[model samples]
Target: METMRVIDKIRQLIPPLSPGYHKGQAGRVCVIGGSDEYTGAPYFSSFSALKLGADMAFVVCQPTAAVAIKSYTPGIN
Candidate 1:
């Protein structure tokens, strides 16, 4: 299956919360794919996870990538 189809299926599987539900009760995800030469990958992954409704997301990367990713945005760290 394609990526979009997979994402759609996941969305379908996730049930909506009740009216009184609070934050951080849904899901948390960490994007762990960055290296000295690849900081944007983690940024994109983390942002995409957030866009997909994850309550929290984090980017784990090598030192060089961490520096660049931090420079990209404080939120990325």
Candidate 2:
């Protein structure tokens, strides 16, 4: 059996960022989850993508939950 470091695996899977790349050239992600009873899960998923170099992250939840999610922060759309 053999093991590889997480960073090594990630580096092999993701392409390097190029200086000439423009917005969204890296990637875009959409997280769909959460509801009136649970909202943080969706927010965490969407924000996680943005933190990982995603150009944009969107969350699709119930209408009522949308308002709650949007109010939580301006970081995600």
The 0-to-1 C-alpha lDDT of every candidate, in the order given, reads: 0.78, 0.84
lDDT of 2 by residue, 22-55 (tens): 9988998878888898999998888788888888
**Candidate 1 wrong stretches, greater than 4 Å:** 1-10, 17-23
Error of 1 at 44 (Å): 0.2
lDDT digits (tens) for residues 1-77 of candidate 1: 69999999988999786767666666778788888887888888877877877777777777778888778766445
Backbone clashes for every candidate come to: 0, 0
Top TM-score hit: 2
Screening candidate 2 with a backbone cut-off below 3 angstroms (N, C-alpha, C), the clashing residue pairs are none
**True lDDT of residue 74, candidate 1:** 69
Q: Which candidate has the top score in lDDT?
A: 2
